[model samples]
Target chain A: MVNERSGRAALAELVTSRSVLVCVGSGGVGKTSMAAALALEAARRGRRTIVVTIDPARRLADALGLERLGGEPLPITELIAASSGLRSGSSPTGSLHALMLDAKATFDDLVTRHATDRAQAERILANRFYHSISTTLSGTQEYMAAEKLGELHTSGRFDLIVVDTPPTRQALDFLDAPGQLARFLDHPAYRLMTGSGSAVSRVAGAAGKRLLRAAARLVGSVALDDAVEFFRAFEGLEAGFLTRALAVRDLLVSAQTGFVVVTSARPEPIAEAGYFLDRLAAQDIPVDAIVANRMTPRFTRLTAAELRRIAAAQDAGGDQVLRTGLAELIELTAAAEAEERALAPLHTGRAIPFQQGPFQQGPFQQVPFQQVPFQQVPLLDHDVHDLGGLEQLRQSAFDD
Target chain B: MDPSAFFTGTAVHLVAGKGGVGRTTLTAALGIAAARVGLEVLLVEIEGRGGLAAGFGHRALGYEETVLAERIRGRSLRAEDCLVEYLGGHGLGLLTRPMVDSGLVEVITRGTPGIKDILLLGKIRQLEQARCADVILVDTPASGHALSFLRSPQGLLDAIDNGPVNDQAVAALHLLQDAARCQVLLVTTPEETPVSETIETAYRLEDEIGLHLGPVLVNGVLARTPHRDTDTGHSNPDDPDPDDPDAEGRWVRELGIDRDLAHAVQQAAVFGRRRRDAQRRQVLRLTEQLPLPRLEVAHRPDGIDDLGALAEELLGGLRAW
Candidate 1:
C-alpha cells in the first residue's frame, strides 16, 4: 500500500513556506488546484493565507465557494463554514483569501502608480500601443501577476501566498520580465526611445531620432511617429517602473520564498520539469518541494510472483470471460510497474545533477544535488468543483 | 464539413490546445499528412519547447528552418532571430545590424511583450505570403496565451493610430480574420479542466477573435478497455456480466494471469472509461453548441511518441472526422 501518512508529513514540512510558495508545472496538471489547496491547508494550520492565480476560469473561485473572482482577495470564511457544516461562531481562526488576476487592470494600475503626472498617465494609458499590449499581449498577464505579487508582499496582507505562474514559456517571461524592464529602463536604447530628459539622453536621443527617421523610411513615417509618441509618454516614469521590477525580482529568489515544481511521473513532464529545475538551480533558487501529480496509481499491492501464481490458478476457472480479463490485467500491471520504475527517482525527490552545456570546458564536476521533500497527488476520480472537493484534494496530497 | 476542406486554400493553420494535449504532435502530424498529399509544409513553434523537432525525430530545431521529412520543414521561432528577420523585412539590415549587435533589440523586444509576438507572427505571415509552403502550420501557446497572441496585432493597431506598426497590425488582422485563409484547430484532451478550457477557447476564437474554426480534434481518447462501466454517460457493449453475449468469452478461456492482474485490467478499464466518457461528453457538447466539425483520435496507451506514429494516427483521426 502507498504510505499515505508519511507522504502527507513530507508535504507538510514544505508547507512552512512562509513568504511565497510558487507552484510551477505544465498546463492541465492540477497546478492551479494545488495552489489553492496549499493555501487552504496553510489556513487550517492557523496561518493566515492567500491563494493567487491567473486562471481565467472559475476553478479556484469555485473551490473557494465564490461565485466569481476579481483582483482583490475574497475571504473564504462563509465557504469554509459551509464546508465544515459549522455556524459562524465556529469558524476557523486563520483567514483564507483568494485573488484572480486582472491583467489589463493591473497594467493600468501600474501605469497610474508610475506616471509622473495625471496628464502624462492619461496620455500613456490612451496610447494605442500601450492599450493594445496591456489588454492583448501574452506578457501583460505575467507582468501584472509579478506586479501584483510585489503589492501583496508590501501590503503585509497575509503570512503566506500560494501563487502559480503562467504556463510554459510565459513562466520564463514572468521571471525575466522584471529584469528586462529594469535593464531597458537604464539602457541607452530606452533613453533614446523616450527622448532627452537629461544631457546623456540628448546625445542618445539624437542618434535614436536619426535611427527612427531611417526606420520610418522603411516601415513608413506614420508607424515610427506612433512608436515615438508611445515612448515619449513614458518620459519620467522609468525609475518607478525599474524600482518595482527589481524589487519583485528580489522577492522571488529570497530565502523565505519556496518553489514547488509540480509534474507527473510521465516521461514528458518529468523531462520538462528537469529542465525547469535545472534553470532554477542555475539561478541558485532553491526548490523545497516537488509534487508528482496524477500518477497512474498502483491498483494492487500484489508482487509479481503472487500475480503469476494467481494467473496459473485462474486458468482453470469456470468463467471464460474472467480468464480473458486475467490476461488483460497482467498486461496492465506490468506497464504500471515499468512506469513506477522509470519515475522512481522523482518519487523520492532525488536530484540527478546534469550539465547545462554539452562541452567539458567548465570547472564544474558531476555532483549529486540536494533531495527535496516529495509528495504524490493520486490520480483522482472526480473533477474538482467545490470547497469539499478541495478538502478531498488536500487529503490526497497531505495526510492531514 | 469535410476534413479535407481544412486543407483547401488554407494558408495558415493555428493549432492551440491546453498544455500537454498533444498540440505539437498534431501539428507535426498535419505537416506530414499535408506533405504526403503533395503540398510543401512548414511547421513553426514558438517558446522553444523543442517539441516540433522531437516530434519529427529530429534534434531540437534552432531559429532557422530545417528539413524534417519529405516536403516538410520545421523551425523554432526565437525572439532574437525574429527581431533580425523583422528588421530585414524593412530592408534596413545594414543599419539595424549594429542595433542587434549592441543588444538594443534584445532590451526593446524583451521588455516589450507584444513586439516579440509580432515578430513571430510577422514571420508566419511572411512564410504565408512568400509561398514558402503550400500552408504554414503553427503550434501556438496554450489556449489563453494563443488567444492573446492572435489579438496582439490589435494592441499594436490601437497603440499606433497611424504608423507601420499600425499597418502591420491591420495586415495581420486582415489575414487572421479572413476565414478563407486561416483555419484555427483547437485540440483538447477529455478531461474536466482541459475540455472546459477548450470550449472557452473555441468561443473566444470564433466570436471575439473572429478566426475561422477548423475541426476540433479531441485527442488522447481511450481505446476499448475490457469492462463494463455502468456509471458512464455513454455505456458500451462490454458491461461486465458474463451472460452479455458480446463479451469476449474465448479470450477468457485463454487467460492465464493472476487476480492482481485481473484487478489491474479492471482498474485500467475504470480509469479509461472515466476519461473516455469525459471526452465523449465534452466533444458532444462542443459539437452540439458550435457549428464546427469534430474529430476523435483513439488514445494510444503510450501517447504519440514520434513523427511516424503521429502521422499514422492523424490519418485515422482525420478519417474519423
Candidate 2:
C-alpha cells in the first residue's frame, strides 16, 4: 500500500526545495493553473519562485490577479496575498514572479545571444525562413521554452523555477524538443546547406546534387536559394545552440530538477499522463508527483440500502419532477463511482511512478518514496480566475 | 442559407477546439449527422491520433481511407506522406528517399514554417475538388495551433512570392476563404475558460484567417431536468423556494425518508442545480459574445454511447440554427 502521509510530505518537500519544477501535461487539463498554484504555494512557504508559463489562454495572468504578463519577469509577490484572499501589504516572507513565454521574442533573443555578432544575428533574424519558423514552427515553442528555462536557471535569479510546458499534441514533445533541435543542428541536411562555396561541391556528391536539383525544381530555385541563404547565415551559431541544448538537457535531468505531471481525471488525460510517466521512466527522469486535476468527487458512501430507501420514499409521495431529479442523481453517483474506479490503476503500482536518483544528501534530494505522490484536485464549482480560487485549489490538492 | 445546409451542402467542415473538449467525438457525430442526410462523409485526422477512429470503434487510421461506418470513412494525413505523394504524382518520386534521408524533406516541410500545414491543406483541397466525399470533416489541431495552422496558407502567400508551394497555398486559401465550400466548426465545453477561448478563437479565425464560422458545438452540457422550477420566476437556483423553507424536513416526515438520506438528496440537488446554472451562464455568455449559432450536446458522464441520438440532437440544433 502507498504511504499516503509520506507521499504528500515528499511532494511538498520537492516543491519547496527543488530548484526546478517542470509541469508537463496535455491541453485543457488545468496544467497551467496547477503550475501557478504550486508556485504560489512555494512562495507562501517562503521560497522565491518564478513560474514560466506557455499558456495560450492567458489564464495564468487571471490566476495571479495580474492584468497581463510579459516576456520579462513580472514581480507578483505583492498581489499574491490579496489574490489568496489575504489583506493588502501582508505579502509572505518569500516572493513570486511570473514570465509568459513569447516564442518569437525569446527565439530572437536566443539568436542574438548565440550569434557571433550583431550583424550575423540581424542577418539570421532577417531571413524569410527564420521570420516565419521562429514562431510558427511546430517545435519552436517547445525548444524556446527549454532555452528560456536554461537561461533563467543559469542566471541564478530565483530559488525555485516552475516551468509550465507547452500544450503539445504529444506531451513528450516538451521533453524531446531540445534533443530534436540538437539533432537537426548536426544533421547532414543542415551541413549540406550551410557548407561554404567549395565545401558545397565536396559535400554534395552526384546523388546529393541531383537531389538538390530535384528539390530546387519542385519548390523553385528561388525558394531553395533563399533557404540555403538562411542556413548559411546560421552556420556559425550551431556550436552555441548545441552547447545550450546540451546544457538544458543536463539541467532537466539534474537532481535539482523535479517533474510534476498534471492531468485531469478524464480517461484521455489519465491515459496521456500514463504515457508521459512511462516515457519519463524510460528516460530515468524522476516524476515527483502527478497532480490529477478536476477529479469527480465520489458520493458512493451512501449504501445501496440507503439509496433504495430514498428511491422508495420518492416513489411513494414525489411528483414526476422529483422522480426525474432522483434518477439523475443516481446516474451521477454511479458515474462518479466509475470515474473513481478508473483511477485505480494510477495508484495500484500498475504504472511506474518513481525512479531512484543518485545518492545525494540535500534538502531537495529524492526521499525514496514507494509511489509517485498522486494528488487529486476536485472539480471546483467555478473556474479559478483569481488567487482565492487558486488558494481553494491548492488546499484541495495538498490537504489530507 | 438553409440551416441544414451547414451539414449537407458544405464541402468541408474543419472541426477545431481546445484539447479535451470532445472535438473528435463531435466530428464523428457530425459525420453521422451528415451521412443520415444521404451525404457521404470523410473524417480526416490531422494529428495522426487514433481519436477520430476510436470514436467509430475502429482501429488506428493510416494514410489510406478506411470505411468507418455505412457512409463514413476516415484517414490520417502526415506532412511527409503528403510530400511523397506530391512528388510521386509529379514524376519526381526518385527524390523522395534521398530527400527524406538527407532530412531535406524535414527542412522543407518543417524548416520552412507553415509548409507542413499548407501541404496537409493542399491534400484536403484535392480530396474536396475530386468530390471524394460530399462532406469532409477535418479534425484539426488543438486551439493553440489551430489559428497558425489555418493561417499558414495566407502567411505563406505573403512570404513566398511564387513557387509550387506558393501555388499550393493559393489553392488552399481559395478553399478556406470560400464560405459555401468550407466552414470551421468550433467545439467547446460549457465552462468559463473554454467558452472564453472559443469566443476568441472564433473571432480570430473569422477576422484574421478570413475563414467561415459554422455553428459552435457546446459539448458536455448538463441536461436540464424536467419539472424543475427553472421556468418559474427564480433565475438563481440558490434562491430557496419561498413555499418550502425546510423541504428536507418535510420529506423526512411525510415520506418516511431518513434524515441523512433526505439531506444527501438535498445536497445532490443543490450541487446539480448550481452546476447546471453555471453551465447555462457560460453558454449564454458564448451566445452573446459570439454571433454564430450553437449546437449543444448533453453531458454523458459515461461517454458518448448513442451516436445516433447525438447525431439527431446535432441535426435538431442545425435545423433550428
Measured by lDDT, the strongest candidate is: 2
**Residues B1-321 of candidate 2: C-alpha lDDT, one tens digit per residue:** 344466655789999999889887788888898899888899999955676776677767889999999999999998878888988887788777888888877787676778888889999999999999988999998887789899999888876767688889999999999998999999999887788889989999999978999889999887766545442313445544422448778767876766765666666666676677678778888988998878788888664346788898888887776
Candidate 2: residue B11 Cα off by (Å): 0.7
| lDDT score for residue A237 of model 2 | 79
Which of the numbered candidates is closest to the native, going by highest TM-score?
A: 2
Per-residue lDDT of candidate 1, residues B1-321 (tens digit): 333555655889999987878787788888887776677888898865676776666767777789998889988887668766667766677768767654455544443456667777877787788988887899998787788778777665644455445566677888889987788999987666677678778888877768888878877765544454533447656455443433343433344434444545466445544655666666666666666766766665433255666666676666665
Scored by lDDT, model 2 comes in at: 0.76
Clashes of each: 16, 0
iRMS (Å) per candidate: 4.7, 5.3
Candidate 1 chain A minimal-lDDT segment of 10 residues: A355-364
* Docking level of model 1: acceptable
lDDT tens readout by residue for model 2, A96-176 = 899998889998988888788999999989888788778777778778888888899889878899998766544456567
